[model samples]
Target: MKRLTSILLSLLIVGSSVLGGCKNKNTSEGKTPESSAATSSVAAPTDKEADIVVIGGGGAGMTAALQASQNGAKNVVIVEKMPQTGGNTVYATGGLNASETSVQKKLNVKDSNQSFIDETIAGGKKLNNPELVKTMVEGSAAAVDWINQIGGDLSELGRSGGMSVDRLHRPKGGAAVGPMIVKTLNENIEKENIPVLLNTTAKEIVLNDKNAIAGVKVADASGEYTIKCKAVVLAAGGFGANSDMVVKYAPNLKGFGTTNHKGATGDGIILAEKANAALVDMEKIQTHPTVEPSTSVMYTEGVRGDGGILVNKEGKRFINELETRDVVSAAILEQPEAISFLIFDQAVREKLSAIEKYINLKIIEEAETPEELAKKIGVDPAAFAETMKAYSQAAASGVDKDFGRKEMKSKLDKPKYYAGKCAPAIHHTMGGVKINTVCEVLKADNAAIPGFFAAGEVTGGVHGGNRIGGNAMADIIVFGRIAANSACKYVEANGGYTEPSIVLEEAETPAVPEVKGNFKDGEYTGKGKGNNGDIEVKVTVKDSSIVSIQVTKHSETPGIYENAEKNVINSIIKKQALKVDTVAGATNSSKGIMEAVNNALNQK
Candidate 1:
């Protein structure tokens, strides 16, 4: 059964959004976010105790905590800096990679560890951790089964992609993979009675008398507190949110913005460095080609799987859209100014749901003449026309001689041409604190930091330079479980370290049944979005937990409302002992709902 779940997880790990795991405003240097708490007077720290302290709340962190509990940790805690628990996972298109599995047998797709490995190395430029990647490839089938046991259904949709077979599986609803995995992991956490601390940021690692990892000093609403734990799992994601880091790591990419969430700073890497963990492949950054250049929000590579084409200002196809992300992105970079437009007719758009939502129906600018459209986007009219002519001829003949683009079945001939201006944006950071196959953080000299572990983008060396479309979620699940199992074993072997006093604070807000309406603040329009919106919410507490919520009005897209609604309801229930689920697509709407919930809770 466990094996079956892993296989299902691998195949179905496709539907989640990338959330721009690591991107920053400035890419001048791979610098950490300027510490907001630096100038402020440091608060005196207090020491609390736990058997395991997982430093993130994504799939990896939750998995580690659950495993720790199963391994006999009486007191385990997950410290998340965000108000929410699931990091980028909640935004992921849930898909996983498995080999030689029952799904493959059922689907009649032949697969093996070698073929998977070859594909990964080929797809990623041989930059992946050979051993760790090996483990992932070999153990993927089993991992999928385990995920299914955790609440995901194995029998789902099968999509075709860069794999040798239909090894990619997706869950029903075809929504965000992050929330689904998170929901399942959270369930296991509750069933085991684990403690999760939200809106908590770890400041520094607490080293004991022996200079080994002792605990983590964190800042929360109650001020600074030290969590003394024997084991610490660093699952704080990547540095994509840190603009400085992006610039420094990807020097070629100037003014490179990101679509990652704001919370995805390289906190784990900094904390691990403070603890002397080795950082590897610090230079290898993954630049996903098709991210919305302005918003930095991802549009998933499944676009190509849905039959999109890459064309220049001339309306000519440039590279093979079906090639690996890195190759395709690099090919696109060769354009005159490191920019090109992704062109597609309305006919192809009808086939891909994600592409339609992201790129819309237009393929390029309409200017009565191709030359006029070229001038609009600043392309040389003659050059653009010639390029387009060449491309149309090649595309019509069914051969992409220029860049070997095999998936040229779709033509760019349409009355209304639309083009998405694309540039290479720093997307995923494939490097960070090094970890073993089981996700234990390895030291500079090559050994496990007994009580320290890392997962997700925080611990690098997984993919050497680039990551496959749906592979990251698989990485999280694989390593998350590893961290959890390891932590649990550590706790079972040695009981919890020590427990310190938790100074509970007074409640400033009261509770309500539910808040009505939405936060309709007409500030920003969807015409040309520039920045991500941030909202502050206060929840009313009764006895130490939230009771209910209320909201005003806010403007956001409706597609995200589906999942956001349920997430708000579930959030209310879990802390309130109610049964609520996360909405499917409406993230901002859900957030607004949470804010309303918090606001209603404040009525003392």
Candidate 2:
């Protein structure tokens, strides 16, 4: 893999031809110039150098750096534009997807890597590079081991869309999986003293006269700087946050708010393109079916994966809830009101620990009986009763006459059933800079660009047309490791020097903000983000004390959150404020309740 002078000249000659048909544009435009003084005071660009540079701090970037270090890379640096690390990886609640892991073997879930490969190819509509998909599937179990070795947890397994078996692995904790991965990877990165440049934005990829990666230009608080590196790994994520990119690429999503983090504006796509990397499937954006309509916060597919059902306005089951995200979203959008309800009972609630948080916020609706719940949510009571009866029968017999549902893990018989209104939100961009099996960035003709690589959502061709839920995590972790291993080979073959002064640094976590001000008594609705969805609450106050709390609606777990709801309400009444210990085993729901109450009080 050594870059000889002849190869460099050959690359420089064809680089223009490689980029000729590519498209490029800034993700957004600032409407007007900043005040003239702001422009006049612009700082000069600084300069630095490295052996390897990672351009994001998400799952992919973090894994890339750790693997690179393990592979004996020195002066490996991760430059993140955000103030903190953990890009979209911090927000994913559904967890990683892998087959035949040690946990799965212990849990006795039947799965094979071939089954995983088949499902992935089918889910991606066969447009996936088979080689890339195979690589992901083969490396998945080992990737899980890698995460576990780094002190990260991937304990629980659930089924997500496009998986033929129960294989999505999440932290046993009910909270989002991203936090666990981020926490572990971050601690390891810091423990290893890997230099991380926070608030550093990569502006462009600089190439030497031979057209290989020379370095990268970046901007930060101290102004712009050049990071001369023999190789670059672009893991900066996708463009769901950029309205312009969304419209230009996936125009069908013009009106949908994205579930992507704001920083997911395809900066990596722009930067990689300048180095002759081609983009693919840029229009293939996948929308999640269960996003809370107004807030656009995702309702994790685990609900359905654990046996939740979708019902329309008429209170009847429509599509099989276990279908792929794209299929379910289309079914929902075609429904009356362009919305649907997710219904589950105590059995499902027991399995989904995170639902408790949504329940305490009142975003999930609950009721003592089916009829009562139907009346409360504007669904036809009679129709709902009949639907429940038939559904019960189907669950008992394992024969779904209406929608052809194959799996019926539990029956929805328990009282205080949970339901939430849902609509689709753009969830993932199944497209970005093109890369091959080893994760080397490629040109339009599919030739590797040598010194550049990409992993995660920032690279396309893994999940071809429509991405499945849990596969996103797998894509990043698997390819990220591959990218790192390949980069190590490149770095070892060709040597580079790093500046001693520019070393790794870690950021300290900020303290939580306390709710301020004395209470004014009034009923107000407040929404708070839960483990997997948004929770809204109605808190009533009188005499500067929370007199009562009514959970009129919610989409959280039943039994677990039920206890938390009662416990939190009583605690709020006793304390006359949201300051209270979270109920054990239902901490997320309890926190959501307290935050919602605090938000309600803040309205005063």
Candidate 3:
């Protein structure tokens, strides 16, 4: 089952939205956010002990734990809520972005960190934390070198949206890099003998009277427990899995198919918020263009990198295919049916993979003539032919006059034409819990929560408003290591965990429940959306108590939402109300369940 899940995850991994993560605001260097805590002050403690407790088992969390162990943290553990590690890390399909790496040097490609930084800032619309972006840019080269050292590779390089240079580095085997990186990290974890507790969910950030992190409360199969760790690193990740949160926060992107796995829900974000960590840019989500229309499958950006043009129903080129995902997505969203088609010739079809699958899945249409391809995909046949001709002319002339695209890798003149219906899907969430350069989680007042830190997709202030393609892996790697290095040093200075003489009073706010209403209730039913489709539920109320909640219909992705479904219904029934921290990463499904329950009990 694990093997099958991993295989499916690898195949489904696609584009900047699924793989890319992180975003930010301004800072001269990777300084604390304006709302940062001043010191790493400690107050109370609890029952168990470990040098560090890293939450989530994805790229950031794994890397942070390994780095900490490497730095001599004797007792380090990774507490993951799922049965296995690899959050969005296992869903990555793109290459890492680095400047002036060994691969670039060997290829004689002239690139600089500053150039990378300039493009990233521009891509992020200048809302990025200049400091964090600079850190990632500076650390990018080292990050690539580190990945290589850790049994990974950068054998192939390509260009992605919003970048002028060919800095996107692929894995050694091919475009499939997610599993390789995950395997390498997992192997490292095994070698270090790091303890990983699967199916363990972090319930709360236990703070002492000093308003500082003391320990964490976690729940596992055995029930809830506490682990007294000197430091907690929240590499848990973003909230793409929770449809309700997405709708509430980024309403502009509501109802779009999301590219995140169910576990990609914003667990660490909530944990941080409860811990007094201020979040940044929570509304900015990166929706990648060219996701397979009407499906969650994502077509890799390499299609466009190898010269694929997106044409609308009128068979006309819209925007530069090589622009940032944010720009390309906006352009596609403006088209009819919120869809377009990716047009390419034999040369592109041959070099690019995913062709057979696209064809088999009926996601792409192939024809010997542009007109035929256009007809099949619902485009104006004559206009499509003309568009192809114009594209060919521009390719030959080295200038795209219609869309002002300068990067022309090939012309769409060859025979055996191919086109795929393309649309955008909500991919990466740019907004998240704020963290400083050293990976320290910050409070609402801009102070560093002494024992709290975060990295990977969970921490914000890295990518800004728009994350440049191929930058997510680089961000996680660079900052994950920084977090570990900082955490280990922190453990040493803070000494071993000890029970303090105090009771917890300055903790986080509990999940607030709605006021009980006087409603003549027996049974009610309603429908709401899960991640992709509708979720229907039947609510049973007895004597004003939510006695039972049963899910009637749902098309949510399996494995991802099973736990979420069981959780949301159970919680509402147990609490007899709709106040609960959404099942960590399955917020959308949970919301749908709640909505259904609400629908069922319409205060008759």
Error of 3 at 301 (Å): 1.7
lDDT, candidate 1, 144-248, per-residue tens: 788887776543433323455556555653444555676677667656556556557899988777766789988764366687778888899888778888778
As a TM-score, model 3 comes out at 0.74
lDDT: which is higher, 2 or 3? 2
Model 2 residue 435 CA deviation in Å: 0.7
For every candidate structure, what is the RMSD over all alpha carbons to the true structure, in angstroms? Answer: 10.7, 11.9, 13.5
Instruction: Write candidate 2's Cα lDDT for 127-237 as tens digits.
Output: 887888999989999989989998878888888876768889987844567767777776666555566665568999988887788898887644566888899999999
Count of steric clashes across candidates, in order:
87, 10, 23
Q: Summarize candidate 3's per-residue lDDT along 1-604 as a digit string, tens digits.
A: 0111110001011111111111001111222211123334322222456668888888889889888877777477777777556688765666789998999999899999999999999999999999999999999888888888977776677788999998988774334456557767876765665666656689998888887667889875334568777789889989888899889897877778887877888988998898899999898888888788566777777778878889998999889999999999999989987888888888877765434445545666789999898888888899989999999999999998888888888897888998888789888888898888888888778899888889988877788899887898898899999999888777778774333221211111222223353445677777876665678887766666776677888765433455566556655654567655466556777787887777777645
Ranking by lDDT: 2, 3, 1
Q: Pick the candidate with the highest lDDT.
A: 2
**Considering lDDT, which of the candidate structures 1 and 3 is the better prediction for this target?**
3
Cα-based TM-score, every candidate = 0.71, 0.78, 0.74
The segments of candidate 1 whose C-alpha lies over 4 angstroms from its true place after superposition are 1-46, 70-74, 153-162, 187-191, 343-352, 355-419, 496-510, 513-604
